[model samples]
Target chain A: AQSVAQPEDQVNVAEGNPLTVKCTYSVSGNPYLFWYVQYPNRGLQFLLKYITGDNLVKGSYGFEAEFNKSQTSFHLKKPSALVSDSALYFCAVRDGKDIFGKGTRLHILP
Target chain B: GAGVSQTPSNKVTEKGKYVELRCDPISGHTALYWYRQSLGQGPEFLIYFQGTGAADDSGLPNDRFFAVRPEGSVSTLKIQRTERGDSAVYLCASSPGVGPLYGYTFGSGTRLTVV
Candidate 1:
């Protein structure tokens, strides 16, 4: 079965420090990877996606993701963290349908 | 400027009752999708519609759940014999076509509570 995995349940980062939220996926054929962020009581906001051509995909809020074919990882990264960046991060893969990861709660400390 | 719209931002229904959740996708977006998000979990796919046809619905938990998009724009998800296990936030999203990296829009979603 196709699936996406976010091993980290929660990740904490001090303000202005680089942050990384790990994600890995398993799917047949070419993989379509995506990252999304959800705030409390709101719907998910689109972050970034990796389809083809580039391994490094940049997305909203100064966030970027590196898609690794051999490792099957598409980890989300940010050069610097902000308090507002704290939220639930979801990794999704588009197979026949979109399969999402369990989600990772990111906390940015002051 | 209008994003995907889901009606009844919150719904509370008793178990064994019937409930309907509605979604209106963005104008000219031909691919519409429905997902269910449980507490502390990511959204799970429920179904997808391309134009007026259901392209995929393999993720629906059971036969009690159904959806329709006769006009190819506004879709309604109907649940029969709702159970407490059915409680979740039903989310709706749309894109221009199948699996595009861009133009996917999501709605606030309807929080369905089954008592």
Candidate 2:
């Protein structure tokens, strides 16, 4: 079985400050990691993914995630946080199929 | 369609009633997937279809839940008996192939409410 976990139920960050949303996973073999954001009453939107090559992968909306092999972690990061970035963040792992974490609510306070 | 489209943005039904949710994937997408999202939770995979054949249906909860994609262009999820526990947002996504790297595009989702 494969699973992903977002340890924090919520993450609070001040506007213009850097933000980090933690994620970890347990899966067999090499894993494909993904980060998605969801707004109220909307579907998940792709943020970034780690397939191969570089440990750090850049994605849409000025977001990026680092794939740490030893730590089995893929944490989403943004150089500067924006109030509009507040939403639910999900970390998912894909081995044979996709497995998603419970989700972490990101709050950017101005 | 330019993006994945799901019909009936919101549906309210009484318990024990049968409900059908439809999904129209982006044109030319060969793979389609169905998932259920409950309050405060992530989307749970229900089924996956490759073309006209179902490649994976193991995620489905039980026999009461079924899905079909005859032409592989559009898919419908059918529930035999609706329950309050079944109330949640059902999401539909389409990918060009079977890989997370491709990043499947998702629809707004169908909000199902069983009273």
Candidate 3:
């Protein structure tokens, strides 16, 4: 069974400060990881994905993720957080069916 | 369509009634997926359609839920004897290909509420 785990339920970060949302996965074969963001009353938007090659993958809206194979982690990161960046973040892994984690609520304090 | 489109932005139905949700995937996308999302939870996969056939449907909760993609471009999710527990946002997404290589383009989703 392919499963993703987001340890933090919520993360609060000060505006302009760096932020990180942790994610880990358990899968049988090669892990294909992805990051998605959902705003209020909106659908999940694709941020970035790690299929192969580069361990550090960059995504939309100044977002990036580091895929650690040994640790089984794909953590979302941003150098400077903005107030508008506050939303629900999801970490997903694809095998046959794409499975998402519970999600972490990111709150950027202004 | 430029992106995935789902009909009925919001729907309210009485318990035991039948309701259907529609999804129009991207024009060239061959893979379509349906998911149900409850409050504060991740999207739960209901089914996946590759072309016109359902490749996987193990995520469907019960027999009351059914889906079809007759033309391979548009898909419909039909629910019978709806219950209050069925209240959640139904999301539709489409990808150009299957598996991990491509990212999906999601629709706004249909908010279904069973009263």
Candidate 4:
């Protein structure tokens, strides 16, 4: 079985400051990781994915994630946070079966 | 191009009533998925379709939940004898069968409220 964990229920960051949302996963074989963002009353939008190759994967809206194999983690990062970037974030793992974390509510303080 | 689209942005029905949610995947996307999202949780996969056939339906909660993609494009998720616990936002997503490399494009979803 595959599973994902997002330890933090909410993350607060100041606008213009960098932000990170932590995610970890457990899978039997090679992991396929993904990050998604959901705005209020909207469906989730794809951010980025880590299937293989590079560890650092850049995605839409200036978002990026680093896949750490040893740590079994893929944390989302933004060089500079924006108020518009505040939303619900989810970390998912696709190992034949796709499993998602409970999600992290991000609040970018203006 | 238009992303995945779902119908009836909001649906409120009484318990035990039957409801059908629809999804129109991207024009060329061959893979479609249905997921349910509760108030504060991440979307949970309900079913996945590769063309006209269901590739995986393990995530479906029970036999009362059924889905069909007869034409391999538009799909419908039907729920019978709905319960209050079934209330949630049903989301639809699609991906071009380009392997797992490509991510899914999601629909705005239909918010189902069981009264």
Task: DockQ winner between 1 and 4, please give it.
Answer: 4
- Compared with the true structure, what per-residue lDDT tens digits does model 3 show for residues A1-110? 99999999999999999999999999998999999999987878999999999999999999999999899999999999999999999999996768999999999999
Each candidate's fnat, in order?
A: 0.58, 0.67, 0.71, 0.62
User: What does candidate 4's lDDT look like per residue over A1-110, in tens digits?
Assistant: 89999999999999999999999999888899999999987778989999999999999999999999999999999999999998999999875435689999999999
Q: Considering only N, C-alpha and C atoms within 3 Å, which residue pairs clash in candidate 2?
A: none
lDDT of each residue in B1-115, candidate 4, tens digit only: 4888899999999999999999999998999999998988888989999899999899999999999999999999999999999999999999987356878889999999999
Better model by TM-score: candidate 2 vs candidate 3: 3
**DockQ (model 2, Cα):** 0.73
Error of 4 at B101 (Å): 0.7
Tens digits of per-residue lDDT, candidate 3, B1-115, equal 8878999999999999999999999999999999999988999999999999999999999999999999899999999999999999999999998988888888999999999
Better of 2 and 4 by DockQ: 2
Chain A TM-scores of each predicted structure, in the order given, are 0.97, 0.96, 0.98, 0.97
When superposed on Cα atoms, how far off is each prediction in RMSD? 1.1, 0.9, 0.8, 1.1
Pick the TM-score winner. Answer: 3
* DockQ, candidate no. 1: 0.66
What ordering of candidates by DockQ runs from best to worst? 3, 2, 4, 1
Kindly state the number of residue pairs that clash in model 1: 0
> Which pairs in model 4 have colliding backbones?
none
Compose the digit string of candidate 1's lDDT tens values, residues B1-115.
3889999999999999999999999999989999999988888899999999999999889999999999999999999999999999999998888864553578999999998
